[model samples]
Target chain A: MSGAPATIKDIARLLGISVSTVSRALKDHPDISADTKEKVNETARRLNYRPNALALGLKSSKSNTIGVIIPEIVHFFFSSVISGIEDAAYETGYNVMVCQTNEMYERETMVAKALLDHRVDGVLVSVAKTSTKFDHLTLLQDNGIPLVFFDRVCAFIETDAVVVDDYKGAYMASEHLISVGCRNIVHLSAPENLLIGKLRKVGYCRALEDNNLQVDPYNIYLCDTSEKVEEKIGRILDRHPRPDGFFAVNDSTAIAVIQHIKKAGLKVPEDIAVVGFGDGPVATICSPTLTTIEQNGYEIGYEAMRFLLDRINKGITAIVARKKVFAPVLVKRESTARRFENR
Target chain B: MSGAPATIKDIARLLGISVSTVSRALKDHPDISADTKEKVNETARRLNYRPNALALGLKSSKSNTIGVIIPEIVHFFFSSVISGIEDAAYETGYNVMVCQTNEMYERETMVAKALLDHRVDGVLVSVAKTSTKFDHLTLLQDNGIPLVFFDRVCAFIETDAVVVDDYKGAYMASEHLISVGCRNIVHLSAPENLLIGKLRKVGYCRALEDNNLQVDPYNIYLCDTSEKVEEKIGRILDRHPRPDGFFAVNDSTAIAVIQHIKKAGLKVPEDIAVVGFGDGPVATICSPTLTTIEQNGYEIGYEAMRFLLDRINKGITAIVARKKVFAPVLVKRESTARRFENR
Candidate 1:
């Protein structure tokens, strides 16, 4: 990579002094005289010297870098998390090496191996939807690398993690619709591989059961890669008795449901109220302004970095694993405020 | 960071062979027989041995990593660009270290220095809004590290770059509004530090000249750290003869203008209309969906990576710096489709 940058040795050679004296002078050490320090500083500036990171890494066995792996960076949720990671990394004098899985397990395994090969001091990860088998993830801890998970995390991984209360968020979404007089509420979700999806589905059912309503399997539609999500939602809407409410796993799905409801000549909230999760910018941009569960991605990222740094600095074996969960807040908006004030 | 991943010495120890033989066998040298290769390969897998990246870097002077610096990663346009970079980097066996400047000149300088310190093979950058100084960027080329600029590019830098024709995009947006019978058009922009903003302003002026309309200085509002954009827009709307149409440098600014217009009790299209640049999902999601100049972000990113890779592989000195420009197409949507059929 251009034969390495100018180093202390280059400055020492230019100034006709020992490398140790040059380093000490650059640090303004008391042992180094003022005249020699000034001379060394001038020479260093002329040579455009920068302390070699690799050499420092070799000396301390620390790169001062934390590897971060996310499902996808293009997604608003993940990018917000990255913003948080960057903010914390900057304050701690650390750099972040980001890897995106794009929701693929195989890519996650490959990226994890590559991160290890880079000799990152620690790794912070949000597992992919397909990350059912986690030998690739546990391999970090196996090799004594500090590991922390955030958001799309695995409970069985035995590591520190930061998560939102997905179950509570889902319950509030469904209960909000019920309070607004929607009898049949439909939930569109994915499989158990992504724990959030399953937790949300469970919470939706629990809300129905708690409200003395039937939790029908027919009301719960799986919207994985099974094709034709719109068609599936359409058929569900055309059932013997139509669903009066919908709660989607995320904003994009909720936006689509709102579009479908409009196509069926139904007014939002008046006929069918919809709520989404993550409460990203899409929630406000959509017509009727989707009422949604807000997961603070920035806070999750900050906590994940804090936890991983703790594990990295304090020996991984010495620290107890933690499961840090943030409570999801229901942001009331036009979409679900039919019988309530629409603010 | 954990004494590096396994090295050739580890594999050789497990196989009871000389380090030279292990290395030669791994490389499939003719001197090393096939039987030894089989044994070495098996042992390498068993020990989970990977060639130490630093060791290889020293041998070949290639880190196989490209540093990527952007203004912000949380934004949709930049994230899409990152997705493309990831796809290309994955295909070419190169890792990416991403840095966000957050539109701060000091951060950009700091990040550039850090990336240089990392000894990255090359750099791919999208300049920040405040990146008026080019010395921080040109230092890479001065040190023989290949540099590629994408999207927010600087023309003075002698490097390969891929960019959307912002001037043309702005022209199309203004001309469309003129065609729709708008007499006075306002341009919302930032300072000249971000070249796209300046180019868009120039194009907006050129469009007015072409349409035989006077380009009024009162219509151009500069939004920087010193002022509140909302109050400025409100004042412009309160002008005796208010602007009939607005063209914003980006979608977020356009959305804000629309909100301000609605608050002023002006009907969109009939009273005022707006168009934005960068046709992202926000365009459709916003009320009176934004008609915008659609820059192919994926293509810009893909081409930037491809060009940078070519420069990286073919030696930056040997190749002439080239500028590749993409034409922006006007995506007709509700916002500027007064005479045209809206989707």
Candidate 2:
């Protein structure tokens, strides 16, 4: 070794192993076998290599900062994810720069370039609802910036992603409503442009088909806001056949549906059982509470950041894209607490 | 005019005024009088000066990015503030980098250094609950980075601050409770180290004294969290001559107090009126919707960022610090909808 100090490259050279393998072993990466890790450790001890050498190698280009892009910061789900990302980053001596797109594609594109200019080491993104083009996202990857998608992913980019099992969550919600003796169900869906939107609708249809119930396309409405509920819900209620249960895309929409149902002199669960996705604080605070799917935002964010950091450290850009899906859980509340005998 | 282009200095020289004054007038800054603004605009038109020249002048060191540091992201108030900051920044072609301290002083200091390293043009901050020392914040000023304090201000730092009128808000809340026939009102306050904590306590006491009621120190409890409420509130309720009302530091604490009061077989407003600060979503969602003070988080954030951007543009570091106080509004709801008979 030179007078200065031994590096990871020196350890790899002494052990006759690849530099990447040595780096992983030093970090005790699960992919690296224990035997290799032990060997790397022994060689590192013999060489008297300092662990900070690994960081020193990337210090020149590394800003020790990560960028996070989300639709909105005031949102409960996204904010929880940010909290998770910040906590995870803090543990490894990294800072986070967060940007909100306000669900605008142009703004998302604008902020992406800003993050690039800031020279962040890696990026964790949940694409905006209005984002259709992937050029801006691809621009980040093209510039050799590591990218990880969480909650929402761009199909055009082949990168690591963390997504909730929206289909399964929606399916479970529909099934629970059916089990509670709901014969006619409605889905307050998201925009068709989003993958999760289509998946959730498909799941609702699948649940109805499996239960031998009619999967009426007319029952599914692209009503995800209070204004939409006000505009379209009255007509749906006044129709010859009314929905007995509602599965909303989010808790806010579900709460809105409940309010509308009550305004029409109806009781939840008795007249219309309701289930929402993303069991945020409002779920418990809403009247009769809200039975919803827990998206586990914090876990998703932490895992996504962890994955992005790993990939950035490994410095492998051409590797196959990785995907991690988190399971969604159904939380029982008064909104869906109804029982009925088998028909 | 030179062959290249006209600049603010040229216009200032023509008008025989300082460059700073000319720049402020061009932007229609409130400090600049209307006469100065018209003169500056008239001179700029005659000189054929491009507004982009102003941006070009600061382009060398300006990252077009601002830093925002708050205690937490999952919090309703802070997240709303972030939304406001992002929107304001976005409107002006600026990006925001947000950091959360989790209320830890060490983390706040570390993130402050990180923002410094990123060379942000300016920073807007809400001091962490655990932060007492002002060295980390002063470091930003030392590095020529303009700083603006919002919501939570550091007493030692000499800079612009945007704070809600916490004392006046608290006074209004206690007075409202008194009007609703809550004679023996207990105050659930924040930590004494916080300025808001002291101000709110004083406000509550003054309200009591003004109403000809005794300002009992024993009735003031240093409780701000649900865990603290669980631990201390039961004892407070069980005390002889049990308190008939509760004034809490924030909405969450007030909600928790309401829950405990209900568990103790007391009816809201009718038996015990409760008032909280920060009229968040939970205030309306809670049963007998809470009557509280609206802190106007978005306005505060927007004003703070705008102020910081102004400071950054003018490039003035040594001056008298400015303070902006937002008046808190009392939002009446079912929680405090009681009428009192003549005492």
How far off is residue B186 in model 2, in Å?
1.2
Per-residue error for A268 in candidate 2, Å, reads 1.9
Candidate 2 residue pairs in clash (backbone atoms < 3 Å): none
Question: Residues B184-220, candidate 1, lDDT per residue (tens digit)?
Answer: 8888876776778789999999999998999999888
**TM-score for all models, in order of appearance:** 0.95, 0.82
Query: Model 1, chain B: what is the TM-score?
Result: 0.95
User: DockQ (Cα-based) per candidate?
Assistant: 0.48, 0.19
Q: Which tens-of-lDDT digit does each residue in A1-343 have in candidate 1? A: 3434677888888888999999899899999999999999898887777776666765676777788899888788899998899888878878888888988999999989887777778999998988889988777777678999898878788888899999999999999988888888989887777888889999999999999889989888777421345768768878878898988888878888887788789899888899889899878777888999998888899889999889888977878788898998999899987775322
Q: How close is chain A of candidate 2 to the true chain A, as a TM-score?
A: 0.82
Query: True contacts preserved, each candidate?
Result: 0.45, 0.41
lDDT of 2 by residue, A35-82 (tens): 999999999877655443114322454657789999988878999999
Residue range B21-79, candidate 2, lDDT tens digits: 99889878999999999999999877655443114312464557789999989988999
